[model samples]
Structures are given as structure tokens and as C-alpha cells.
Target: MHAITKTKPVPFLDLSAQYKSLEAEWLAAIRETGARGSFILGPNTQALEKEFAEYVGVKHAIAVANGTDSLFLSLRALGVGKGDEVVTTPFTFFASAETIDMAGATPVFADILPGSLCLDPASVRARITAKTKAIVTVHIFGYPTEMGEIMEIAKKHKLAVVEDCAQSFGALHNGKVVGSIGDTGSFSFYPTKVLGCYGDGGMVTTHSDAVDERIRRLRNHGAVKPFVHTEIGMNSRLDEVQAAVLRIKLRHIKDDIAGRQKVAQEYTQRLAGSPVKTPSLPKNGTHVFNLYTIRVPKRDAVRQALTDAQIGTSQCYPQGLHLQEVYKHLGYKPGSLPACEHATTETLSLPIYPGMPLDHIERVCEVLLEAVRG
Candidate 1:
């Protein structure tokens, strides 16, 4: 075994470093957003909606309170409800499946592709049945899902398709932006995401004007007027302040994605042929490197070693949603959906954000090697 190693203090995420680069501009924008006093459904929100819609190459973008709400509204807009089933990958953030349940539908688990770690279309096809009304395919870890195959299956089954692009804004599949490829594309601006705002915010992208109109109403208490309610809807609107912050961040998103790509490349070059299964990029998809994840044996020990070495690491979905007690009623066992289940035990995400330096990447690789040597 290699000798245990040490590293200088490393943070899992350095949001402050990114903020410092844009501090002056962001502060000014925040003050401006506040002064307008048009806190909700204001000019900033409308502007962001237009810009983001264009960025994703879609006709409409509906701003919502958060990512989960974006997915919920998408399901509602697609007419997904009780006695319906939405086919989804088990190897993703729970919100993908949870939104289906929130929309009064069941979430059917599907396996993921071995290479891209996105939903496998064959698995999706196998799971489809009469109850299946839609497919919610997640772009896991910023890698675009196989949209072509999934879309064909959805078309064959007459099902709606929702692209869970929360981790994959700006990513592309077959030259088309991920959000534009589905009936609705959902994005999150949580503080940690690549294109994050100052606080919680999310948006849904769609080409259908009809779906856009429904989402617009659903986000604001299902009302066309101030007091009249057309249908029961939840409160989920992106306020002006958050929208303004998003607008500022959006301008630099391409540059941010480039920087993250650099870090990911460095990690891959440094860790090549090591005892870890490095993240893979598909030939047909563009990767945004939201979180550079790897699968390794003895994940816990490596995590502890990295912690001891002052290098930060974390587990992404350490337990797959199906294995959780919350959904034990689904009757999934250890062998069910083996790909996602195996990933839950072996995956670990390393720090690879825009602001990390090459030295940090090198030290991280060195420390990881030492930890796994044991």
C-alpha cells in the first residue's frame, strides 16, 4: 500500500471565490432589484425568462420558486395525476421521482446507462405500460441523457417527456440544448449549482405555448386576476431579487462552464488508470461537469482519508431512493436496478468547480491515491 498522504486545507465548494470575481457587479444588481419594488412577476423575472428561453433554444421559460416546484409544475402542465405513472431513473436526485408523486402519480424506476450514468432508454422502454403517462429523464452530474432514444420511446408510447436538467444547464445532446429536447426542461439555481443565484430559484423550458400558459397560471395560484382562482395551485414564483441575481449569473455561465471543464479534464488526466472509475462523457452529449464523481471500492475509507488530509469529498446519493425506507413499499430489493444500486455504494464526488486551482487538483489526486492504496 502507498503511504498515507496529507494535503493543505481544501473546501468541497468555494462559492466565495466565484463571488469575489463578480462581487461589484452582483452587489449593484441586487440593490437595483430591491429598489424596483416589483418583487414578483416583475421586469427582471420576465427578462430572465426571455433570456433563458433563448439560451436553451426554447420558446418559453417559466420561472418558479425552486427546482422541485419546476418539476411539479411540469407534471401538472402535462396532465400527470393520480393513477398515472412517470418512468424515471432511480440513479438521480429524489426530487425527480418525488415530483411525480407530488403530482399524484407513481414513479417507475428505470436503470441508467453504464457509460453516461443517465437513463437507459432500453430500461425505460421495458418499464413502460398502459399506466405510463410520461418519462422524467434526469441529466445526472451534468451529462445529458440519451434524449434521442428516450424521445422515440415516448413518441411510440404517446407519453410526455420531461428533461430534469437541474444539474445540466448548458449541456447539449446531439447539438440541441437538453431543455429544448423534451416537453419541459427544469433548471435549479440553488447556491451550489453551476448557474446559481443568490437564493433559491428555478425555471422550466418548453416549446409548447399551451404548456407555457398552464405553467404560468400554476406558478401564481392558478389565477388570471389578482383574487380569482381558476384552479387549485401551489405558491411557487421566482421573485425579482432572485431573478436579477440569476440574470447577472447567466451572463457568465458559458465562461463558468469552461472553467469547470478545465478542472474536470485536469482531474481525469491526473487520476487516469487509478483505482477509481472516473466519470465518462458520451459521444453524443456535452458534459458541464457540475460534480466530478467517481466510483471506487472502500469509498468510506477514502472519504475519511481525504478528510484527514484536509481535502474535501462527498457522497452523491449514497443511498438510492428505491432503497430508502421512505419507498420500501415499492418492493425493490438489493438486486433491483443493480446499476443505480451499485453506484449508491461506490460513488464519491470530488471538488471540481470553476475556482479550484491546478495545485488543488493535483493534491486531491495525490491524496485520493494514498487513501485507496490501503
Candidate 2:
């Protein structure tokens, strides 16, 4: 085993560093919102929706409470409810499948592609049945899925497509932004994400005006006007404070993505020829490097070595959705989805964030390589 040397611990995500850089702007925006006292769906929220829609090249963008709410609302707007099944990858966060259940629909598990670690088109095809109504494709780790193939399958099956772009804010596939490609794209602004805010926030993007209008109503208790409920909808409105913070952050999203790309490049270069298998960026897509995950043999031992070395790491989804106790009622066993199961065992996410110093990247790589070899 390699000797473990203690050093100042690196964080899996340094939101503090990012906040420090934008503290002035963030505080200013927050104070401005406080001054206005327009806390819910205020000017900042409206502006952010417009700006984000323009950035994503979508016709509409509706700000919501959080990523999961974004997914649930999108599913509901698409009329996917009781007696419907949503095909999605099991190798993602619980919210991906949980949202389908929230919409009163069944979440059918599908295996991910070995290379991209995204919902495999073939696997999705096999999972579709008479009850399948939509496909929620998660852009895991900021790598775009094979959208062209997935879209084709969706069209042939007449299923709605929802792009879970929680980790891929600025990523592109085939010269088009991800959120704009699907029927509805759900995004998260959790502090750790690439285009995160100071607190929880999310957005739903769509090309159809009707869907956009429906989501607007659904996010606010299904009321077209105050106190006149048309349908039962949850209170999932994005707060003005978060919207204000997000607006400032959204202005620099492109630069943030570039910074993450640089860090990913440095990590890839430094880890070249090491035992670890680096993340693969798709040929026809742009990767924003939300998480610089690598597959290493003896993954747990390497993770422990890095921990001992004061270097942080994470296993994003160590257990796939199918393997989770919450989803046990879905009848998925350990070997139910081989690809997702294998990925869960081998994948480990290294510290990655926008504006990460090159020295930090080097230190992480040095420790990681030594740990992997040992």
C-alpha cells in the first residue's frame, strides 16, 4: 500500500470558494430582493426564466422549487399519471425515479450504456410496454446521452421525453442544448451543481407554449388566479431570493463551464497511463465536467487511501436506484441490471468544481494515482 500523507483536506465541492468570489454580487442581489419584498415569483424569477430560456434556446422556462419538483411538474404537464410507466435509467439519483412515482406513474428501470453511463437506448426500448408514457433521460455526470437515438425511440413509441439536466447546465449535444432537445428539460440549482444558486432552485424548459402554461399553473397549486384551484398541484414556486442569486450566477455560467473543463483536462492529463479509467466525453457533445468520476480497481481501498491522504472523494450513487431499499418493491434484485450494478461498484467521483486551482488538481491526481497503484 502507498504511504498516506496528511494534508489540508480537499472538499468534494468547494462552494465556499465559489461563493467567496461572488459574495459581493450575491449579497447585492439578495439585499435587493429583500428591499423589494417580492419574495415569490418576483421580477428576478421572471428575468431568470427569460435569460435561461434564451441561453438554452428554448421557448419557455418555468422556475420551480427544486429539481425533483421540476421533474414531477414536467411529468404532470405531459399528462403522465395513473396507469403510466416512465422509462428511465436506474443508475441515477433517486429523484429521477421518485418523481415518476410522485406523478402517480410507475418508473420502469433501464440499464445504462457502458461508455456514457447514460440510459441505454436499447435497454429503454426493451423496457417500454403498453403502459409506458414517457422517457426521463438523465444526463449523468454532465455527459450528454445519445439524444438522437433516444429521441428516435421516443418518437416511434409516441412517448414524451424529459431531459433531467440537473448536472448539465451548459452541456450541448449535436450543436443543441440538452434542455431544448427534449419535450421538457428539468434542471437543478443545488449549490453543488455547475450553475447552482445560494440555495435550492430548479427550472423546467420546454418548446410548447401549452406545456409551459400548464407547468406555471402546476407549480402554484394549479390556480390560474389566486384561490381558484383548477386541479390539485403542489406549492413548488422558486423563491425570489434564490432566483436573484441564480440570475447573477447564470450570467457567468459559460465561464464556469470553461473552468470545469480546464480542471477536467488537467486531471485527465495528469492521470494518463494510470490504472484509473477516466471519464469519457461523447464525440458529438460538450461535457461540462460536473463530476470527474474515474473507475478504479479496488475502489473502496483507493477511496479510503485518498481519505487518509486528506483528499476528498465521493461515490455519486454508490447504489443504483434498483438496488436501493426504497425501490425494493419494484422487484429489482442485485443482478437485475448488470451494467448499473457494475458501475455502482467501480465508479468514484474526485473533487471537481469551477475555478479549481491547477495545483489542487495536481495534488488530487498525484494522490489518486498513488492510491490506485498501491
Candidate 3:
């Protein structure tokens, strides 16, 4: 294969470059944490929680171990449990549904809107039953779902609305941030997210004091006092080191999100009139540009061609959750949810992070267009 060499290289994520940019500041924060000798549930963790709560426009924000735990804790705080059904989209990351299970509830699958790739509110209405206790609408790929209608539907049904903001930390819906609109919102700080820490981190945001109390107590083993347990809870507290790193990055989040928005605009401009279908923005929401995904007819073939050309591409979800073997007992056959199935087969995620330059994105787009034409 010495005869075949790539003209360009593209990676799905360049975490190393991002880290390098903040190496000096990150190392200083880490050394300071070590010097302080307070690694868990300390000053940095508390400060991060306060700052994050204010940023999300919520009354309280509780730091958790990771995104899945954030969802599980939110469901638990809302008093969802065994035999209860939580309506959610089957077209998102598995963590959205997995957390429902972790909260001891059954996950009810719903179809997502075709254009926006978020929960279809009308479909959600049809899925509601007496057993339905809550709705977990995932803001997939950092694009906010239409929340105004979804919130109205939830209110009519007397169901709690949990915004799965794991992919949308800074996204907005109708001039308001996503995490602040729902009954509660969950976020993930995985290394690849728009606003991420050096290690795993998560947050739960809410306006209700009662719900906040539940999450606070639950993350700390259900104890109101030290060594005294009231209810059963799990160990899901954020570490001080991750909180420190997140605090440093949080100050620059607006700038980071602005950079991403600029890149997304460039992609939209360049990809216009192409055969591949580009993602559309919702009427009432601001997309944070977590992943710039598009739908194409020959998705698999184009993906392979990109890989051959040293251009990285990702398939967000190859199979819908309802069609997965784990949920076979739900009795959802292949054709039952046609929209979700179709999306799974055709959707492809492209790299669109803040660290890359405009010329790099243009090069990626050219490679992508060429691959599709072949």
C-alpha cells in the first residue's frame, strides 16, 4: 500500500490539540488541587455547581459523576420508579434510555421529528398512557428540540419534562437556554462535548427546590447527615479535579460556542445545493454545533470512501433503540418505527468542533462531496 498515500487527514475529534492549548492553565489548576489536599466534594466542586446553575438560568445545579447518572438522578428526583413509563426518543444515544432503566422505570420509545432529528411532540402525545410519568426529550447533537409544544403537552398530561441536555450545554430555545425550560435538565461533560472537562463530569439543573433537594440527597447516599442514611442512594459525586478544570473552561464557554456557531455557518454555506441533505435548525432553538450531521442515500459507501481518503466520519446510531436486541421484548419490529429506522440507516456525523480552522472544514467538505459523487 506504499503506492497509496492520503492527500489530507481529518480526525473526528482533536482532543489532544484542545488540551495542548490549555496545558499551562490545566496543569496549574491540577497542582493547586493537589496542594489544597481536598479532592472530593470540596470548594471547587461547590463553586462549579453555583456557576453552572447561574449559566443555565436555573435555581440549582448539582454536579454528578457522569451523564447517565445525571439522568438517573433526575428521574429519581421526579419520583419515577418501577412500572412507570418514561417517554423518550429512540433515535438518540443509548444513555437517554439506559438512565430511565437505571431509575427502575420502563422506557417507552417515541419517533423523532424527521427534519430536526429531535422528539416529535405529536408522536409523543400518541405514546402517552396512564403509566407514563415523564418525558425525556434529548437535544440530540446539540440542537434544541421544539420545547414550547412539548412542554404544553407534558403539562396537559401532568407529566414531568426532563430535558436531556447532555448534547446541548449552551443551546437555546426561543431566547432561553434549553436547560432552564424543562422541569429539569441533564448535561454531560465528556471529553468530546462542546464544554468538556479533562475527565468525566455531569450536572442536573432545575428550578424547584424540592427536586433539587432530592438530587442533592441522592448523589450523597441519601444521607441528610454524615454517616446517617435515610433512603437508598448511589455514589455519584463529581471529583474536585474535574470541577477545577471545568471551572477554568466555563469562563470561556461563550467564546467556544461562538466559534462553533461560526463553523456551523460556514458548513451550511459551503454544503448548500449539494446532493446530501444537511441538518436544519429548529425555528425556536439555537444549535450549539456539537456534531454537524447530514443524511445521504449512499451513506455507508460514502463513509467508507471518506475513511479510505483519511477523512474521519461517524455513524451516530447505526440501529434504533427499539430495533436493538436489548429491547426485543418491547415488541417493536423493524417496520414499527419507520422514521427512526430510516434515520439510523442514512445519518452520518461530521467533525465540527471549535478547535478546527475554516480551511480544514472546507477541505473536509470537498472530500465529502467528492466521495458522494463517486
Candidate 4:
């Protein structure tokens, strides 16, 4: 296909087209649920939990209000509270580290692996102390880290592993879904995720029966029964509306992921022989390509060029978590995590959503090449 229009800026995410495609079905689901008065954690939520668990190949899936709650509840259920430390990478979104803090645990920062940009196993190993209770491995940009190595390390240290699957809803490692490998898998459905809904939603997956039960109770005010409360807990239940929306999208997750893969492949092919370094995909599993990030020299200049050319780009993260103001009390200074700090200055995410036009990809590649080669 040829360019749709060279002057038209490439969007950062084409959620509009995605919404339009399923508008009719989505409206009907919403209407049906509302008419039935199934507002709270009702049949739809129950069914979504079952369906999502099967999709992840896990024994249990608990739906929650949002992704942050998923992580917080998982940590709490895993008994990670006061004076505990959770090891995680410094390169991910704030929610990754903040959830650990919310669970009353300290977040110990680790350097990122250069290529995958996920937690470096070596760094994670070095950061562990006697107080370390768990490891949160994030699959940044839908490209999984070496889960086998992470799991092995966790097993050796008797640490709980929570796979942050927010950006990697359908991604796999060694033919198994990402969430199935960890002690508890946390996911987000914030409309832009791989298997997103119209509004906020999240899920927690686990194979341990005890963990599952604890999460279920923790998500609903820590009650053993409806009224009899035990420990204090947050009201973090997923509503029926979001669940209704998620059910429809979950059915097409495989196709949606495949579309993202196609877009990423085309971008790689088109950017060949250029200065932009495309994403380094996982060798042993599928990369669903939630974000097609590239590292280039003069990253800011290139981003400005894309903007001037009417092409949109995003900064996955502009600063490392180690240097954030809130974590200053942890006593980390600049240059502490070299790899993550460098990435903060060089990475830019290009647009790559499901059903993105070939012509759009072409225009994006053209603009990117010019910006970097200039």
C-alpha cells in the first residue's frame, strides 16, 4: 500500500479506530449489563476471571479496579509488608515501584538489561538482601525478560516473583504465557494495554490456591464472609461495565497481538541500514510489541524532528526510578544505575497499534530515518 497522506501526522496510538470497530458490540454489552442491574462484581466479572485465567493458563484469576491495585493486592496477599524489600528494575513506569511502596515494602532498584530493557538478573541478584521478600519482573514493551533465569533466581532465594504483565497481556516465554510462570501475575487494562478495555481494569493470576483465596478476600475489604471483616483492606473490586468490555476484547487478543507484531516487523524492515536501533526481541518467546521503542543518538532532537514532521512519539520514561524525588530517602545518587540512566536519555517509542495502516508505518519510517540521518 502507498502512503495515506504524507502530511498527516502519525498518531501515537489509534485507539479511536479500535473503538469504532467494536463500538456496536461494546454498546450492546454495556446496555445489557446495565439493564440487568449487574453493576458491581457480578456475573460478567466472575466470567471474565474464569476466562482470563484460562487464557493465561493459570488456575485462578482475580479481577480488580485497576492495575496498581492488582500489584498492591498481590503483594499484600503474598505477605509483603512492613520492613520488607522488593527488588525491581528502575526503567519501568512508576506503578511498578509505587505498588511495592503501597504494600508497605521498600523498593530496591536494579539496573536494566541493555537489550530487553527489563530487570537484569545479575543486578537483581546483587540487590537482594535478607530483607528482600519478592521480585517484580516487568515485561517492558511486551518483550519478556529471561523468565527462566528470573524464576531460577527467585527459587534459589525463596523470593516471590510477580510478573508485571500490564504491557504484555498476550506475550509468552518458552511457549508458556508470562503470567503463568510467576508466583502472581499482575495485569492492567488501561485502554492502551495489549488486551485493554474502555476504562480502567486489572487482573491478578496465580496457581497457588492459598494466594488466590487471600487475593479474593483482600480485594473485597478483607472479609472472610460478606459482613464479617478480618484485616483491613482496600475496596478494589472490578465493576461489571469494565468486565463486560474486557470480555469482548479478550476474545480477540491473539489477533490484536499478531497485528502489533506485523507493525513492528514492518518497522524493523523499513528502518534497516538506518541509525535508529530497533527493539531487541526475545529469542525464546513472542514479543507482542506494545511499544516499538528505538534508541537513537540525539534522542531529543529526533523526537522534535518527528513532532515537526507531524509524527507523534513518546518518552517511555524520561528519568530512572532510582533518582525520583520520592525515593531520595533511599539514598541513591546520580549514575548509580548506569544502564537505566543512559536509556532514560536515548529511548523513544514510535506508534504501533493493532490495525495501523501500512502507509502509516511507511510514513513513520520515513520521518524517523530523516530525523536520525540528518
Candidate 5:
């Protein structure tokens, strides 16, 4: 009789472990804010904006209610509205394109690079037309896009550039931080993001003082002064509680990113020579490893095997934006963007986070290998 061996289940993202690690600091900050009676856009939020701006090497940072609003407000502040077209990659979260539509602009789809899954600069150039007013570039899975080329393209066309930093809190491109390179950058603090708050929170970074002042007013119902509305705007202020929580987490972000990098290296080393194509890091950029995604055959089957073994996994996006029913009216056929469609079919995100155990990585690789071989 062989002895039974038990395997510990690995979660895709262990938010509880993360919370436990900083419970004391987070609790203290929350308690202090509650005692101060400053709930909405107060000292904590203001301080967070200042610290975040410094971190991103930007002149200003505006804290908003969520990531979507960050993008919407950035577009609106740039005067992108009806009859305008925003160019962006189709292989990303819907918000990247949805916000363009929310701003009353049409989203023009561009393909992505097969390796990095970031927008292809050539594809972006091909999409530009007379109506194109902006480009919303997303750092998918924390991999920075080729900003040098994209920036040149934007400059040639005189288009506004909005960097969607939702999945890339600390990623860098060509020795420059992502948020600082573009005209405006939007960051999300959803619980699963690289640097997240307890609840929904977001920030916008920019170097232009004019854009900064406009976004500040746009976030607060276009109020240049208290109760004085200049233009129609929605309410999207970051709460002091979430701001305090983010401030504490920001203190440990570097260490957290290091831990995630370690885990990613382990996965790459272990999965070497396997059919699975591991993430490729750019020599001139830094990847924060928000989601350690890989390309593999039989992706769905492998994902199912991992799930059956009680090891969690995810598909960051099962469908590209052009293929979504909402965009069917855009008249894009199935193969309009081959790279983006291929990515949707092949990519799978394995369990990964800061401080993940080596044993868990080994188990996931073992299960994935067996499934792939079979």
C-alpha cells in the first residue's frame, strides 16, 4: 500500500495573505482617518497624490474613484469627445476601449506584438486617420509597450497619448516609468492589481499643469471652486480610507514587486524546455509581474486540470475587444486582428503573487506538464 501524498492548493491571488502581512499598519491608518472625521478627498488622499506623483516621476497625480474614471477623465480633459477616434490594442481589458466610447469617441482597434502582448507600433500607425485624436496604450500584464516608437508616432500625428497603467503600477520602459512617458497615465488599485488598495481606487499622472488642473476639476463635478460647476462632470473622488490604505501599501511596493519577480524567475526556470512559452521581459524595461501569463497549447484543458487539482488559474481575457458583442457594430471580422485573436485563444495566467511559496510553483508546473503531455 502506497502512502497518500497531499498537495496544498494554491490560489490565483492570495489577497488574505497580503492583507494579513499589513493588517496592523492598514488598521492603524484606517483608525486614524476615522478619528479625524475627514472621509472624502481629505489629507490622506492629498498626501497619497503627492507621494504617488513623486513615485511615478510625474509633476502631478490625481486620485479618482476607480481606474475607468481615470481613463474617462483623461480623455475628456484632453477634449476627446464625439466624432473623435482613439486608437488602442484590442487585446486588453474592455475598459481600455470602453472608456473611449464612454467619452463619446470611437475606439479604433490595433493588433499587438506576439511576444510582449503590448500594442504593435506599426499596427497603431496603420490605424491612425483624420478622426484619430488619441491613443490609449495599455501595459498588458505589466509589460510596457514600445513607447519610443509609439511616442514618435503620436507626436507625428499630434495625438494625445493616454497610458493605461491599470496592470502596471511600477513597470518601466527604456529606463522611464510608464506613467511619466505619456501625456496622461491612468492607474487602477483594484484588489488584484500590482499595487492595490483595500477597495476600488485609481490615480492619474501627468506632466502638464493645465491637464492636471482640468482633471482635478473634472473629478469633482467640474468644480473650480466649491459649488461652482464650470462644465458637466461626474463625481469621482477617491475616499480618504482607500487613500490611507494605499499609502501604507505604497511603502512596501518595492519589496512586494521583488517577491513577485522571484516567483516569476522560478516559474521560468522550472518550465524551461517545455512547450509552454514563458513571458519574455524586455532588456530595457522592468516587468512588475502583475500576472505571470504564459502561452500554451490546449490552454483550456490545462486550465481545467489545474482547477481540478484545486490549483487556481485564470484567463486575463477570453475574448478580444473587437470580438465582443458590444463592438460587433464596429464591423470587425473574426480575423481582423490575428495577433490579438490568437492571444485570446492561447494565453493562461497561473497562480502567482508576491511571496508565493516555491512548493506551490512546483506543484502547478507538475500538474501543467502532465496535462500538456497527455
Candidate 6:
């Protein structure tokens, strides 16, 4: 018999740690922005857009207020509206589908692949109808969705594709990055994201010139000139202060992503004998380790045991969107998405940051292994 030792509590994510390491750079950028008094879609914001576009390997990147707006604008610019259906995964944040509904389109739920926990190409093909206008393939937990397969499916059906890359900023699929593969790539720079800023910010990426033009106009009240409106739009511009910080962070993203990948490797090696399902390996470069999630028996019990041990944990998405109360009008039943429903019950995300300490990861695994044993 072994007596497992407990240590200090680990934070689910350490945003403060990351900030402290880059304090000098962050402060410098803030000072520069303040000195210029150029806020709100200024030079910093424009420069960030260019850097991000190049990072994602896309022709255009439009900075927006938040992730939801990034998706909403993508759908609107791609001509998704009333009487149209957008096929998307059921096991993810509600915002993925909510943005579709907000664009006045019907949200069609699709099952996920058991291994990837991402939208299944077969399920997507089954769900497409004559009225299906687009597909919003969400790269959940930073694993790039099966884009090549999905892209082929889209081409056969002539459907537009929006890569909801909220959690997959630097992740790549095949030889290409995520946002560049789809017609439009939507990103969220929420504080906890892999490339997050101090506050909320987002960007939309695309290869088409016309789509880029529409999003630029739609983000600022559909006006070609100041105080002159061509159509209806919203105020969803990324501010200069956030952009400045992002520019600094963007420079270090490659190394940060490498750190995350190393952490994931340690986790996979440590949890070798545990009777839990670890994340599947990604196809290209790596999964980027945005969230190092696993599936275990009695998941809720395991989570409780970890909590009692002063270790942080999280169930990324406890309930599928198709089964939520708000989506009742969609008329989906319990078995609507089997793979998605299965994930909702078992997925558990552990503490993972770019530079997460090895001792902390060991403690997390020890607690998790013990809980699953019982």
C-alpha cells in the first residue's frame, strides 16, 4: 500500500504567472499606447491584425471586440441568415451555436468523432440538407477538427465553412494552420486562451477579399465613411491597449506553445498505467495543449476527490448544447448525439499552463490516479 502525499493547491490556470514573467514587455507596450493616446482601432490594433493574419497563414484578419462577434460577423458576411441551417458540433460552448442562431440561422447539431471529440465528417454529411448554408467546425480543446475531411464534405455540398478557433489559436491541422483552411476562422482572445490578452479581444480570418471587405464594414456599423451608414452593423473593434499587449505576446507564442506541448508529453507519460482515456494525439505539429483533458470512470467523483486534495480541475463542457434547456426548440432528444453526450459525462480538464511546474503536474496525476483506483 502507498500513502500519497498532498501539496499546495494548484490553480486551474495561472494567468498571473504568465503576466508576471512578461511584465516588462507588457508595461512597455502599455506605456507606448498611453503616450500616443491612440486607442480604439489604432495603429497597434491594425498591426496586431497583420501579425495575427500572418501567424494564421490567412490573407486577412479582422480584429473584433470578442469571440462571439467574430463568429457572428463571419456568418453574416458569408450570407448565413434566416431559413438557413448551420451544421456544428453539439459538445462545446453554447456560443458556437448561439452565434449561428444570433445570425438568424437554424442551429443544426452534429455528432462528434469518438476519438477526436470533434465534429464527425460522416455525421456532418448526414445532417446537411438543401437549406444548409454553412458548417461551423469547432476545434474543441485545441485539437484541430478534421478540417480536410470537413472541407471535402463542404465542397461536395457547396457549404461555407467557419473555423471556430476560440481555443486553437496556434494549433495546426495537416500542413496548414486552422483559420487559413476554412473560409473564415473565428478566434477568441479571452484571458484564459492560449494567446489571450489582458481583456477580451478576438479576430476573424479569411482568404477571400470580398469576405474581408464585408467584415470590415460590418464591424463598424456598415459605413464606408465616417457618420455615413450603408447598412446595419455593430461596434466590435479591438481596442489599442489590448492590441499592444497582444503584439508582445504574439512574439512569444511559438515558445509558449512548445512549453504546452512538453507539459502534455509529461502528462501522457505519467498517466500511463491509470485506467483513464487520455487525449488522442494530433495529426500535425501537436494539439498545442490548450486544455490537457482526460476521461475517467466516475468523473464527478474524481473531480470531488481532487477538489478535496486542494488540486484544481474542470469539466470543460458538462452538458451538450443539444440537450440544454435553451435549445429545446431545436427538438433534439437525449440520443441525438451519442459521441457528444458521452463526452459531456466523462471529460475532465486538469491544470495546464505554458510553464506548469513538473511537481505540480505529478501531484495532480497522483490525486487523479488514486481517485480513479477507488
Sequence-dependent TM-score of model 2: 0.97
Candidate 3 wrong stretches, greater than 4 Å: 1-6
How far residue 186's Cα lies from its native spot in candidate 6, in Å, is 0.4
Instruction: Please give each candidate's TM-score.
Output: 0.97, 0.97, 0.97, 0.98, 0.98, 0.98
Error of 2 at 77 (Å): 0.5
lDDT of each: 0.90, 0.91, 0.89, 0.92, 0.92, 0.91
Error of 4 at 365 (Å): 1.0
* Cα lDDT of model 2 by residue, 1-374, tens digit: 23423475777788787788889998888788889989999999999999999999999999999999999999999999999999999988889999999899989999998888999999999998999999999999999999999999999999999999999888999999989999999999998898897788899999999999999998999999999989998899999989988888888888899999999998898888889899998999899888998898899999998888788898977898887888888898888899999998899999998877666777788878888877
Better of 3 and 5 by lDDT: 5
Tell me the tens digit of each residue's lDDT in model 4 across 1-374.
58457689788898998788889989999899979987999999999999999999999999999999999999999999999999998899999999999989999999999899999999998998999999999999999879998999999999999999999988989999989999999999998899988789999999999999998888889898989888898799999989988998888888899999999999999887889899998899989998999999999999998898888889999999999999999999998999999999999999989999888899888888988888
Candidate 1 ranges with C-alpha deviation above 4 Å: 1-7
| Predicted structure 6: lDDT | 0.91
Model 4 CA deviation exceeding 4 Å by range: 1-4
lDDT by residue (tens digit), candidate 5, 251-282: 99999999899999999998999898999898
Query: Whose TM-score is higher: candidate 2's or candidate 6's?
Result: 6
Please report how far candidate 3 places residue 139 from its true position, in Å. 0.4
Candidate 6, residues 1-374, lDDT tens digits: the string is: 23445658888988777889889988888898899999999999999999999989989999999999999999999999999999999888888999999999999999998878889999999999999999999998889998889999999999999999998888888878888998999999998888899899999999999999999999999988899988899999999999999998999999888988898888899899779889998766458778899998899999999999998888978999998999998899998898888888899999888888888888888888889998
Using lDDT as the yardstick, the better of models 1 and 4 is 4
Q: What would the TM-score be for candidate 4 when compared with the true structure?
A: 0.98
Clashes of each: 0, 0, 0, 0, 0, 0
Greater TM-score among 1 and 5 belongs to: 5
Query: Candidate 5's error at 194, in angstroms?
Result: 0.6
